[model samples]
Target chain A: MQDQLKLQRAALADFGLFAFRCDDVDELLHRATELVSEALDVPLVKVLEHWPDRGEMLIRAGVNWQPGVVGHETFGDDVRSPGGYALRCDEPVVSPDLDVENRFEMPEVLRRHGVRSMVNVVIAGEGPAYGVLEVDAQQPRGFTEDDVAFLRSYANLLAAAIERVRVHEELRRSAREQGILARELGHRVRNLLSLVRALASRTSAQGRTAEEFRTAFIDRLQALSTAESLVFESNRERTDPLVLAEEVLAPHRQEDAGSISIEGSSVDLSARQARMFGLALHELATNAAKYGALSVAGGKVSLGWDLEAQKGARKRLSMTWQESDGPEITPPQLKGFGTRLLEDVVARELNGEAKLAYRAQGLNYTLSFTVDG
Target chain B: MIDNKDGNLSGRRVLVVEDEHLIAMDVQDILEGWGCTVMGPVASAAAALELIEGDLPDAAVLDVNLNGGTSEPVAEALRNGKCPFLVMTAYNASHLFGALAGAPLLNKPVDETKLRQELSALLADTASDRCSGT
Candidate 1:
């Protein structure tokens, strides 16, 4: 018996070395059961993994079990089963005789294998119990205190190994996700650079002085920058259109407090949508201050939006920019940068349509675009 | 500030496929400045394909990523119609897969001079191919 205990200690040391270095959890669990079975001189051994979501313990790994019993078996997590009882009590449980034992229900597979006795210990980790480890013997015998001590040590090693593997996998996944996000951010940065280049080139210099050109270009860039920051500051994949409007129009709002009104329900817009819409709003406000409504006292600008349900998880957003009480407006002979941007560029970008009506009272602009919810 | 020295692309029709409005507008402006009659600067693969079916352009400029999906279908359609197209993208070469592989690639914020030169070369090559009848 002293020699047998020495052999068990050697097996435990051998398994401790293997478990710490092994990366695969499956191999670790299977090797543990095999080592314990050999050390204890038991024919049947298994590891039941606790699946909290399923509320059951799965036979994850085992040694010397029946052909179909190892991986294809499950047991209730409740205290009715021997393994469950050990897990609940946080102590080792020993059934010296199963046929005469009325404390726990006998498992069908153990009975089939003629299991007369078994010992189980909880495989516990720092967070929660991993599961239960059990060894079964064909002949009825009391499990010695030394046997329980060996099993407890083996279970503690298994739990530590399991946790190590889980943490390693989490680290690997987080690194991969960060790599993807970095690549995506790089792509977006390049795209934004391209957009700024486009805006600089498209900001026309047909009839304006260099200083005028600078102000116009800077204002447009400021609008784009404001939109980009709003999208980033929110840290959301999508941005709120009303908040976007409010932010973009804040500069124009101070001089005319009640002159500008934005009325819209909460709706989400893609980053791209918000930027373009913000630029359009800037142009509209600039035009209003220069020629249309916000130029004079008592001139009013109201931006209203409505959402209508469309087929297949899409919604249609219709926004109207109305200017009133300014000057008797006459349509300009030549289309300006703002006119072309609103009519063609903004409409095409949103996959929508925009109409500008140079009414005698004020400029009425309406645009409709699709939103993916 | 694009220099149109030769005026070679006097009447060539080039279809522009890009999702970003500013980029699309700039491309249109540049191509038109070169005297090319630019076709729809379509924002999606479906729209580009429909435009191709309607009237095949002389050549095409395709952005690899369109909104949430890739432009492989548009590339395939352009290939089937024997239409030459160059990819302008912010992504790397690996992003171009299957039908899009090995096509001419011009990185985003494309140099207007290089774009003009590449288009001229593509047209020159196609003109020679027609002459060779291969």
Candidate 2:
């Protein structure tokens, strides 16, 4: 009895150190069953996890058991097994004999292995009992109450280790997600700073007077800011060309949707293309409202597009804008910010050409660009 | 502040390669104000290269991201033409052109006075490089 007590003490100490070194739960459980087998001088030791939904306990890890018994085996939690009794009582169960056991029947596999005695301890976990840890012997023998107590402590250590690994994995996943979000924020801020710097210098040059400069700069900045808000809020890298036109013309068409018309096939513009075209549409709408069709009571603007061609992997889109019933129009004296933006920046951004004209009747515009379909 | 031997930037052709029109126009305005003749304000590297073959200018200004990519090909053409050029870019990085290491760099929203000074230095360097036969 004294020797058995000393052996059990050493087993608990060794397992306590083992738990600290285990990298994962599977390794912890497998090593634990091996430790139980060595410390108790038993032939069979197994850890079975509860699967209440399946109404069974599965052999998660074991020692001195057949290859088919570990991992690929399960047994019911009915009243016949020691594991079942432990779970039903939520405590340890000791069955020193199977030959004359009246309450539980001996399983064929255990009977085949000449097992006549068994002791099981419940493995306590977060919300419920995780499973049972059992030791088997071929001969019926005395199983002290102290031995059941020792097994219960070992099972507790296993549950704690599993929970530790799960929490670690969760933390690491959340940290990685935060890192990606921070990088995207930094990239956007840098781009915006560069954009404003370029805008200020160019807009100031367009101003002949300080007042003219303020008006042009403020209007341009407002347009860029609004477009940026719409693009980011959509949370999509590409924007629909038709939606862009409607949004840029929203203020002009307020309570007068009939004054402006938009028609186009479904086309998604790339991020760079979207920003450039969004700004272009803003300028066009602003011009029409100030001097073209949208300026007069009877004038109206119509925008339209068509798929010009689809060559294998590339698609070309052609668009047009015209004003009708506006007062007589004439070409501007010189190229201003609007004219330069339409004919130069917009054309360059789309890798296409833009034709802008001021006929006696109205302003006529045509543009075309190609994109991957 | 090196003066054009002719006492004016007039008659000295300046090639301009920039993707953004308004910014390009700013550069064109500055060059024209200095009395220099502005060549193509071409918006792409390919177009800039074509212009270089037709008539290489005395100097050029380039943007790093032309059509969303580096303008190294146009830089190469400018180098081969023995035409001095400086980059005015929004990007602050060395990888813009790893091979074009020694060329001058100017930042976006260019300080007009500094742009002219850098252009003079680049032009002078190109002239000396030719005189030395490198």
Candidate 3:
């Protein structure tokens, strides 16, 4: 008996240390079962959790079970089961003999396993209840009151460990989510910088002056910023292409006048597509403000799009920007940054075809892409 | 027939694996201006890997993160196949662990001139011995 008490103290001390060593709830629960078994010298000790909603007890954690992992279930919780009896009250239920014990039903889960005697203690009872702790024996045995008291203390420690793990799991989940969010923010910033660098490079290649490149690049960046903000505000992957065009042209439009006329219906574009398309609009609007229809009084620009019929029953969304009522258009000797962005980058990125015409009357830019919707 | 500043990158195929569209376009222009043939500015690492499986390029410029996925598999393939490649990333070197730690890394907002200079030297050295067989 002296040895038994000493072993119990050793087991209790080990369990306290074990709680701090686990990274997973499964490992923590398994260690609890292992410690319980070692303390009492039982081969089969388990944590049977009450599932009132499920109308049965579940084997949450177990040791030396012949089948299954932590998810396995237990038999009905009728009065025949000592776990059920312990769950009904706050105290421990001690069954010394199953041969003549008629107080409760011996489930097949226990009887088939050759279990003769068992002690079931309520794990926690401050509120609803955590579950029942079952320590079983294969041979007939009478459990002393001291044994019951010691088992209760063990159950209390197990309950506290479960709560600790629950809080730990919550903290881990929050940290993981924060990590993902930070990564996403980092990705967005990187993409923004790359885009800016590319824009500056291409703009400088064709820009006649430093001022021209700076002005054009910043406008394009603003358009990109607008598209990103709209997407972020909606908290969705798809943004309205019409809204994208309007937002890009908003700053360029003549104050309180009919300088820009829009004619397109709403259509969905992926965030990537929206940003590319939005940049194209910024280029067109900026060019119009510089030398196209928006440069003169009563000058006007028509920005419109429609679903057009394609070969083999496919549909294409065609967007057009026509400028009129400005000075007679003179084709530039070299294609500028706006032309390259519209004709090359936008076309390539959206899988569309772009055409820029320096017509006698004004400039007309058109793009046709397969409707994503 | 190669110089440090102006190597004959003409007609040499170089694969560009980048997810950002405009950056890829800039790379294409710079590579094309140097007279090199561009293989791809592929949007994802998986697609880039698929493209190189059938026919390897003379050299490769791989972005470390392809649409939020690591381009390590492509890097591993290039290494295993005795191919030379450059790694570009927005992430820091400390965050890069394991088999991927020690390779060359160029940060985002890449300096195009430096990239060209490095590539020219890399190609000039290997182009003499490497392209002769392929």
Candidate 4:
């Protein structure tokens, strides 16, 4: 009786530690299997659960079992079978001598695996029996009634822990999927808004009475929108100027099929600079279409750009817009809204300077700006 | 100067370069009511150019976008031939012709009265120029 009380206290203490511990499921299961094997001093200990569809007893965890024996072995749903009989009773069943117990009918497979005595505890719950936890030894009459009671209690704790860990793993997976979906949705929303803004700007510009300003402003807005979409879509901190320019100009290819002319070495621009340049190009294209070469049949617009190291130890980007074969143009008497928009609004907003020239043959516009490294 | 009250637009030939079929028909009806000959509600830039090459209209009302691209070529041809042309665009004038900054532009949905007044003025100028032989 004294030994029984000492064993009960030790089992309760181990149960308390298992209940409060918050380790991962695999680690927790491994520790539980080790503790049960040690506490019971059984040669083999295993936790098995019912496979409802297959109607069999399948091992979830095992200690001191031969390689591949735990996962591969199973007891089917025959009521006459030993495992099925234990599940039906919903109580611990000790077989002191399996060879003499005729009603027990232990399978030949179990005997081949060298099992002599066995204690099986049904994991009964609010619903149907879950399965059984079993301890096996080579010597007959090895398991007592006390061993059956101790194993049943241990099985209850393991079942609760498994359910808790399953819920935790599922929650983690759900949270990770939600985070990815949210980021993708945000990016798509931003792109759609940018597109709407570009459409609005173009519509407003095309309503201008002064044809020159109308063309210049519309083209510039289109270019800016294109570049803005590219940068936002890339999700990158920096972009190359040449690649950005190409994307902006792609939609405005000449009717004659002449490729857009590029004239500069590659320069890397910060995200802000790339957007600013996009807006500037839009303005240039609009102007070219209204009075420059783009306004005439078979006319060509040439884009030239170069980078200069300024005296202030800053790199300045210079771009020139030239048009040929367009209508004979005369200088405007007043600075129009487009001029103000590009030279004042855009330049001030982007920290750049612009020059506008209304030549007799076409229009020439230049923009110079510093870009951050 | 031609008086606004004058109903007749006899001997006047008008070119209509609009992409939308419904809008083109509306403009055609307006010109015909004024007793002018209406040439086309041309759908594409190529078609407009073809019509212009065949017969020069006394005046034209052009939409800035036709089919997929700009109607700048039609505008250019009219300017080269010294024919008076007005642009009709859904886009604002300041946005439509940035480089050739000072051309006459009309916004859509167009104000019929303004369009009539501008067309009358342009026709009157052309008639006077012909009389003066300049």
Candidate 5:
């Protein structure tokens, strides 16, 4: 009697340390299986959950069981197995002689897996049974009442640990979803503010005259807004220069009637360059429509670009906007806001150079810049 | 602002679908001044659908984008109803609504004279067709 008391005290102390040391669900289950098998001196210890929907017992964790049969084995719909009966009734079930108990029938599945005698303790959390913790032996080894009671206490602690881990995983998933939503909202707000800025700039440039300027300003702002929408839809960190050029030129493309040609290799530009380039293209297209190529019948505008490698391992992009076949060309006496915007403002903001050359036939503008790597 | 040169649509009903309140009101005024009975200035696709179901208009002026790029359903319904509608958009008309390939397009903020001219032409065509049927 004294030896049995000592054994019970030792088993209880081991189970207390094992439960406290577990950090997560998998760790807790692993340690519980090890502790139970070692304390009861049984060859196999398993924690099986009764899936009521499936009417099956699933071995969630196991120790010292058959090499491959631990998690893969399942006992279906049979209340005969010790685990199923213990989980259903929320009781500790012990079979001293499996051949004797009429209601306690041994499942052939468990018997084939070398489980002879077993004690199943129902693992309960707050209200009902969560699963079953079982200790099994290859031979007909009888379990004392003290062993069953100790296992029942440990089973409750394991169930609580499992619930804590599940809550932690849910919190992590919620945090990730919230982060994604916040990022998308910020991106949309930034794009809207940029649109407003472009509108203000275009309106300010069209002179102080109310009706005439408003008409021209709205036309230009609409063009910029279209380009901005395309950039946002692409979801690119840096806009592709070739794509920006195509979007700005789309409204002016006419098949075999009037030509607006583009020639260059594809290059990716930063957002600043993309926006400034879009503004410059809008200015060029407007000029073409009013006094240059596109204004006359059968007139054409050619836009071309090339990337030159610099000595310091940098690439300089050179672009030219040219117009042909229009009315007699003459330089304006005073520089308009369009000229100042294209020549000084856009060039300075983008860290580039712009030159406007008034040729005999049409207007020619060149822009050059070294982009960052 | 409504140029009723042919004077065909002096009593026909017209619907205006625009998200911007000022723009919608301007369009309504233009259509009403043309002697056409105007239905709405509805802001969203849902509201437009509700208005149409309540009283189907003879024609509509639709903004290609509202809330986002989701005005295609409204366009489809109008087409199914066999209503000759015009699209008013700030976007590049070809790029945004290319699928409605041969439909009439008017860019916004609309020019007053151009808006009057186009609306008159479209309404006159619709009125003549109805007269021929009768």
Candidate 6:
């Protein structure tokens, strides 16, 4: 008995080392079952993994079981099964003789294998119990306290190994995801810089003084910055178009609170869409404040949007910027940056069209775009 | 062989395929300033392909990634037409796969002078190839 205890102790130490080096949970579990069987001199030893959702303990790994037994067999998670009882009570359950034992019902797999005696101990981790490690013998025999203690120790080692591997895998996955996010952020910054360059170069300096140019460029940049902030703060793939419009027009709304009217149905827009839409709105508001309706008191600028259902789950958003009660309007003699940005740039970007009419009373601007419904 | 003259790009039709509206307009403005007749600043692959089918330009300038889709198909179509083109991207050429992997690559924000120089080289090459008629 003393020699057998020494052999079991030696097996436990060797397994501890093996578990320390092994990274794969499956290989460790299988190795654990084999080591337990060898140390106990039992014909069958199995590791049953607990599935709380299914309320079943699956035979995840085993030694000396029939070909179809391991990975295809399950034991009930209720107290009627020795593995379940041991797991529930967090203690070893020993059935010295199944022929005379009336406490627990024999599992079908054990009955098929002619297993007459068994010992079960819970394999517990730092978080929760992993499952039960069970050793079965064909002959009717008793399992001593020493055997139970050794088996418990072996189970503990296996649980620690499983947890370590799980944590390692999780860390690796997060690191990979972080790398992707960093690369994506870099790409976005580059695109933004390119966009700023485009804006600067395209903002014609033909007529405006240096001060005027600076103000116009800064205002446009501020509009873009506002759009970006809104897109990020929403923390979603799409942002509310109405909220975006209100936010972009917030600065100009202070002087003539009732003059600028913005009404729109709830709609979601992508980051790019919101940016382009916001820039166009900024241009319209700037133009209105300078030469159109918002330039004088009692002038009015009403912006309204309507959604029209289109074919194949698509929706068309039609927005009208109607200005009134200001100085009489006349078409510009030459096409400027503002006109090109509204009619050409914004339209092409949104895959839509923008029409501006310099009417006698006011400037009427209409924008129409298609979006996924 | 190859002419790097100022008026060489004049009357040449160049198609521009880019998803970003501002960038697209900027490219159009630059190419138009060079006296090249810009066919498009199309945003998507389908639109670019449609334009290609309707009429092939003298050459093309394509962005590698168009919105969510790659410009590989458009590059393939341009290749079949034997039209010379250059690629502009926010990424490295190694990141590009298939046909875009080997095409002339320019990173954004593209240098206006370099863009002109590269287009001149491509146009010069094509012009020389036509004269040789081999």
The TM-scores, chain A only, for the candidates as listed are 0.88, 0.74, 0.83, 0.51, 0.56, 0.95
**DockQ of candidate model 6:** 0.73
Q: What is the lDDT of residue A1 in candidate 5?
A: 52
lDDT per residue for candidate 1 within A1-373, as digits (tens), equals 9987998999889988998789899999999999998899998899999887887888999998878887789998888888778888889998888877776788787888889999999999767799999999999989999999999998988999999999998999999999999999999898998988898898889889999999999999998888898888886767888888998899889986799999998777888888889988999998999998888999999999999999987899999999999988888898877788888888988879999999977999999999886
lDDT string for model 4 (A1-373, tens) is 5675466558657765875575475566556667766676666777666787897877666787777766777877556667777887777778877877665677765677677788888765436666677777777865656666677777777667666666777898899999877865554344334333333433444445677546554565566566666666676656777788777766656455463476765766765567667766665666666656766677777777888886665677888877766777776666654565567545654567887787765677788787643
lDDT of 4: 0.67
Query: On TM-score, who's better, 4 or 6?
Result: 6
For residues A159-230, could you state the per-residue lDDT of candidate 2 as single tens digits?
777667667768888999898787666645645655665567666454378887776667767766766766
Of the two candidates 1 and 2, the one with more favorable DockQ, higher being better, is 1
The fnat score for candidate 3 comes to 0.66
Q: What interface-residue Cα RMSD does candidate 5 give after superposition?
A: 12.2
* Tens digit per residue, CA lDDT, model 4, B1-134: 55423534666888898765435655766677777788786867788889888477878888776656777787787776777778766655655663224567776655667778777766776664432212
**By summed lDDT, which 10 consecutive residues of candidate 6 chain A come out lowest?**
A232-241
Interface RMSD of each: 1.0, 3.4, 1.7, 15.4, 12.2, 1.0
Candidate 3 off by > 4 Å: A1-3, A24-27, A41-44, A63-73, A77-81, A95-104, A114-117, A125-128, A137-142, A169-181, A205-212, A307-316, A360-362, B5-21, B28-105, B127-134
| Residue-level lDDT tens digits of model 6 in B17-133 | 998979988899899998998977888889999987847787889998887898889888877777888999888778878777788888889789889988988887777553211
The residue-by-residue lDDT of candidate 5 on B1-134, one tens digit each, is 24345554678788888764434555665677678788777767887888787456777788876756555666776776776777776654454554354567776566657766676777666654442211
What is residue A205's positional error in candidate 4, in angstroms? Answer: 4.9
User: Candidate 5's residue-wise lDDT over A1-373, tens digit each?
Assistant: 5666566567667756765655577677877888777777777888886677888888878887667766777776357667777776668888766657666667765677677688888877555566788888877867777777777777777777776666677888899999877866664454445344434443444346777777667766766565566566766746666788777777777544346888876766765567678878888888777778777777777888889887665678899988887766777787765676679656765667999888976889999887653
Interface RMSD of 6: 1.0
> For candidate 2, what TM-score does chain B get against the true chain B?
0.84
Docking class of predicted structure 1: medium
> Could you list the chain B TM-scores for each candidate?
0.88, 0.84, 0.84, 0.84, 0.81, 0.90
Select the stronger candidate by lDDT from 3 and 5.
Answer: 3
A16 Cα displacement, candidate 5 (Å): 16
Q: For candidate 2, what is the recovered fraction of reference interface contacts?
A: 0.25
Report lDDT (Cα) of residue B8, candidate 4: 42
Candidate 4 off by > 4 Å: A19-26, A124-129, A142-145, A205-373, B1-134
